[model samples]
Target chain A: MSAPVSGGDRLSAVRAGMAADGIDALVLRPSPDFRFLGGRGDGFLVVTMDGAAETADPRPYLPPGVRRVGVDPEMRVRELFGLAVDAELVPAAQVLAPLRLRKEPYEVAMVERAALAADSVLACAPELSWFGATERAMATRLRVLALEAGCEEVLSVRVTAGPGTAAPGSAPSDRVINPGDALLVSLSARWDGYCAEVARVFAVAEPPEDYDAVYSVVVAARHAGMAAARPGVPAAAVAAAVAQAVDDSGYGRFAAPGAGRGVGLGSDEGPRLRADDDTPLEAGMVLCLEPAIYVPDLFGARVADIVACTESGPRPLTTAPSSLPVLER
Target chain B: MSAPVSGGDRLSAVRAGMAADGIDALVLRPSPDFRFLGGRGDGFLVVTMDGAAETADPRPYLPPGVRRVGVDPEMRVRELFGLAVDAELVPAAQVLAPLRLRKEPYEVAMVERAALAADSVLACAPELSWFGATERAMATRLRVLALEAGCEEVLSVRVTAGPGTAAPGSAPSDRVINPGDALLVSLSARWDGYCAEVARVFAVAEPPEDYDAVYSVVVAARHAGMAAARPGVPAAAVAAAVAQAVDDSGYGRFAAPGAGRGVGLGSDEGPRLRADDDTPLEAGMVLCLEPAIYVPDLFGARVADIVACTESGPRPLTTAPSSLPVLER
Candidate 1:
C-alpha cells in the first residue's frame, strides 16, 4: 500500500502554485479541493498564499494556514461552525476556482491509480456476461472491482445495452443484454480523492462484420488525439483531430465534436478537448480521450483511454486493449 | 413503481413559488435542482421569474428545449456550465440556495422515500455481526440493502469503529470490530435523486455502565428537540435543547451542541440545527436530529433520526428503536 502523503507536503504544493500564479491567497469550498489540501475540515478553507505554515496543537491534522469558515448560517449548524477555532473561518462561497484547478504531484499520482483501476475494471469486462445480467448488476460488478483495486469510492458506473444503450453521461437502466446488441460501459473510480474514468464497448454475441471498421475509426481518432497531446498544443486541435477522423469515416453525425476532457480529482476535470477550447496542453496534466460514434436508436461505440502528458509526449495510463469489441458468449 | 411526475405539474409549482418569492428568474445549475424542475439539462437551467424555463436536453435523454448551447468555449468541458442561446445563461450560483432550500411536495416525497431506505438499512444493522465481518463488508451490505429497497444510489456510508469511533463525520476505516469497541455507522441514501442521512452507535461487546446514562440523555434530548420542531420554531432552540440534556447528564464534553440539520434531497440541506442559527423551521422541511457525545480517545454515542416538520409537530420518519445500544457478540 502506498504511504499516505502528509498534509504539509500537499499544502506546500498549493503554496507554490499560488506564488507562481501571483495569487494572494487561496480559498477552497467544501468540495474535493478542501479535502485535497486539508487533512480534515468539513467546512471550507482560506489558505493565505504565504510560505510554510502550521496549524496549532490539538487540531494538528488541519492544513497549515487554513481557516475553517462557518457553514452558511442558512445552511450549516451554528455550533458545528465553531468546532475548529484554531484555523481562520470564512464563507465557503467566497472561495475562488482558478487556483484549485491545477493538479499537484500527489493528486496526480492518486488520479493515475484511479485511472489504472478503471482500466483494470474494463479489462475484466469479458467476465461480465451479457445474458441474464442486468445493467445494474454489471454496474455493481464494476464498482466492486474498483473498490478491490484500492479505489476509495466509485463515482459512477453507467452501463447500457441493446439498441437503447445511451451515450456517456447517461444513467444505467435495468436493460438486459441480448445477442447482437451493443454494450457500452463507462466507469469512474476515485482513489485517494482523485478520479479516473474509462469506457469500453462490447458486442454481446458475435462481432458484427462491420465492427472492425467502426472500432478502427474510433481507435484511430483516439490515437490521433493522443498523438497531438503535448505542452503548448491547443486543446481544440485535439478535439478537431478526433472529429475529423469520425467525419472522414462517414460517422460525423454520431461523432461528438470533442471526444473527452481532462480526468483528475473529479470525474470531469479541467481543460476540455473541444473545438473552441484554446487552453494549451501542459506537462503533468492528465486527460481522457474518448472518441464516440452513435447511430441513434440503433447502436453506439466509444473508445476511451486515460493519457498523461509527459516531457516526451502523451503516455497511455490505461493499458486495457481497445482494438476491437469483445464478443462474449 | 412510483409514477414519474409530469413536467406540467412541476412547472406549475415553480410558477407558484416564483410569484410568492417575487423572484423574476431562477438560474439552476446542472445539479439536483435542474432535475427537480422537470428538466434534464447538462446540469444547467434558466427559469424566468415568470416561471418559463429552457434547458439543454440531458445529453442522453435530450429532453425538449427551446434553444441549446453546446459546451462553453472558455470554460472547462467537464464543469457544469450550460450553453444556452435564447435564454440568458446567467451563472447559477446566485439562485441555487433559494430554489433548493424550499421543499416542494414532490421533493418531500422523494426525500421521504430516501429516509425510509435509510431506516431499512439501520434495521439490518443487527445482522452485521457475522464472523470476520470487515468494515467494507458491512458498508457493502448497507449499500445493497438500500439498492434493494429501490434507492438509485447511495450518497455515502461512513463507518468508524474501535478507539477513534466517537467523532461525527469520521470516515470509514478498515479496522475490524473487536470486542468492547464502539462502532459508529452513519449512512446517507439517495432515491430518485434525493438524499437522506442517519447514524447509530453500536457496541461490539458489553457496554460500559455509563452507556445507559449517556444514551438516555441523548434520547431525551432528541425528543425534546423534536417537540420544538414546529413551523415557526428557531433552528437554534432545537440544538440548545440537546446540548442542555447532555449538560444536565454531566457529560457536557461529549455533547455535540449542533448535532442535527435539515435533511432533504441533499445530505446537508439548508436550515442547520445549530445554537446560533435563527432560521425558522418550516412545515414542509425534513431534518436529521443527531445528538452525539464523544469522549476523546474513548467512546462516543450518537442516535440520529429523520424528522419531517409539520404544523402540529415533528413527525419521526425513522422508526428504528433507539432505547439502548445493541451489544453484539
Candidate 2:
C-alpha cells in the first residue's frame, strides 16, 4: 500500500517504460528508484523478459544476463558492473526518474501522512525558540516529535539560529538564541516510503526592515508558485510566476532558480521548477516550494511547504501556518 | 577540522596512492570519496598536478580536460565523460577505498564525539520503557536527545515492538508495548560529517527462553569482535573471532559474515569484517560491531557498539552498557 503503483501495476509500468526505450533489462542499485520496485537489499536488482530478482550478494550490477541496455544512476558502481556484467549500461535517471511521478492511492496517502506528520512536528518550532535554547537542541526535539507522529525516518534537520541562520547547515552547538536573530528550521520526514519537507523562519525579537522585506517577498513568491501549479501546466510556468513576484518586490536578484522541486521517495526528484524544464504538471505530483533569500553571514528569510497537484488546483499538504512569525522574547 | 587528514594532507595521500599506480588526472564524482577531498558542490572533482576544482554544476563524471590516465568509479558516467572528456578513464575504488582507511586526528575526534552523543541518548532507553508507552514515542524521545547532544543528523531509527521486532523495520504506530514483547531499537547519529551507530534489545516484563539465549550469544559475539579488533590485525580476523563465539553458543547459522564495519564520514566505509577482505587494521580506525540473531516472526536480539582501534587495543567509543535489560511492567 505504501507504493503508488503497487505490485502488478509497478511491473506493468516498468514494462511500458522499457518498451518505449527498447530496453530489455535493467540493473538498479540501492536507491529510491529501486525501492519503488519493492527492493529491500544492498544488492542490485535485475529485471528482464523473465522476471525480477535481487542478487544474493552485494555487487555493482546485475548478474550476467542478456539485455539491450542496463541502467545505473551512480557513476562509480556502474563502471565496475560494465566490466563484470555483460550488458550496455545506460543512464538510469533518464529512464527511471519519470516512473515515480504519477502516484497511486497508497503512495499518495503515504506522502500526505508524511507531510501532515512533518507539519505537526514543525508547529512546535516557535515554542521551542527562546533565549539560551541551542539550535541543535530544538532540531532534535523536532525530529523526536516527527518519530512520534509515525514517521519511519527524519531526513534532515538543518535548523540554525543567530549567526548561522543565513547559511544552511546543522550541528546545533553552543550558539545561544539571542533577541532580534532570524531562526530557520528546515526538516524533512519519511513515512512508509514517501517523503515531504517543511521549512519555517521565525523572528525572536523586533526584526530589521530588511528582514521583513525579504520575508514578505518570499511569502508572496511561494504563494505564486502554488497558485500557478496545476494539471497540464508547464513546471517552468510556476517558477516564472514565482520569479515575477520576487522581481516586482525588488529582490529579483535573490530569486534563485529551482525555487521548487518534486518531493516523494527522493526529496529532489521528478519535475524541477526552473526556467528551462517544461515538464507539465500532472496530478499526484507532490512539490515543495522554498523561496529563500540569503545574504551570506548576515540575516535571511525562507519559507517552504509541500503542495499536491490535483485536477482542481494545488492543495497544500503541510498545514502548518505559513505566515511570518515575529515573536517577542 | 572535520577530516582526519586535514587540508593539504588529503591531497598528499591521494597523490601517494596515485603515484603508486602510475595514475594522473584523477576524475572523482560527487560522493563521500570526493567529499573526503574537501569538495563542496554537486560537480565532480578533477585532481591533477595543478589542483582540484568542482564542475560548474552537478554531473555524473568529470568534464573534458587535457590529462593522462583519467580515473573514475562509475561506468555509465565514465562512458559519457569518455565521449565528452579527453582522457582515459580507469577505475577508482581499488585506489580510493584504501585511501580512506587511515584516519587523521580530526576525523577520529569527530567520530568519537558522534559516538558519545549517540550513546548518551540511547542510554535512556531502559528508563523510557513502560506498560503502555508506544514504540514510536520512545524512538522519538531517543532521537530528540541525540540532537540535543550536538548531533547534526539522525541517520536512521528502526525501532519495532511486539510481532514486528523479529523483522527489522519502523513506524511506531498503534502497536502497543505489551509485556514479554521483544523490542529492537537501532539508531545512528552524525556529527560534522562523521557518523556512529548503536543498537539495543529490550525485554519488557518477561522474555522467552529462546530470546534470552539469543541475547546472550549476540553479546558474547560482540565482545569477541571487539577483543579481536586492534591495530595491525586483519579485518577478517575479528569476524572470525565473532563467528567462533556464535558457533560455540549454537547460533552459527545466525552469525552473518559482516559482523562489523568501518564508521567515519560515511556510515558504511573502509574494510568490512568478512572472510575475504585482508585489509590490515590501522590505528585510529573506528569500527562498529553489530552481532544480531533473528528468528523469523517469533523473536530477535541484537547489540552493537562503536570501537576505535589503537596501538593499545580496541577502545569502545559508544559506552551504552551492553548488558541485557529486562524491564518489568
Chain A TM-score vs. truth, each candidate: 0.77, 0.87
Per-prediction TM-score, please?
0.74, 0.80
lDDT for each candidate structure: 0.66, 0.74
Please give the clash total of every predicted structure, in order. 7, 9
Model 2 whole-model lDDT (C-alpha atoms): 0.74
lDDT (10s digit) by residue, model 2, range A1-329: 12346567777778778778777777776667778888786666767655788884333333345556656564344334454645555665556777787676667778888888887777766566466777666666677677767787878876677657666544555677778888787878888778888888877776655777788888888898899999898999988998899999987776666678898887778789888989988888889888777767676677778888887889887643546687666
A1-329 per-residue lDDT for model 1 (tens digits)? 12223455666655555555444444444356566555354544546544322232223334455444322112222222224344433333233233334456676677788887888878878776668778887787777677666677787888888766535457766777777777788888787777888888788876555666777788888888888888778888889888888889897887865878887755775678988888777776788889988777677778778888766888888743557656668
**Candidate 1 to native Cα RMSD, angstroms:** 7.9
DockQ by candidate, in order: 0.08, 0.38
Candidate that scores best on lDDT: 2
CAPRI grade of model 2:
acceptable
Checking candidate 2 for backbone clashes, the offending pairs are A75-B74, A76-B73, A76-B74, A79-B74, A79-B75, A136-A172, B4-B104, B4-B107, B64-B85
lDDT of 2 at A234: 92
Write candidate 2's Cα lDDT for B1-329 as tens digits: 12345567878877777778767667666555777888666556777655677774323333345444545454344345344544544666656777677687788888888887787777776677557877666666777677667687787766787668666544555677888888888888888788888888878888866787788888888899999998778999988988899999887875555787898877888788888878888887889888777777787777779988887898887643556688776
Fraction of native Cα contacts kept in each candidate?
Answer: 0.00, 0.54
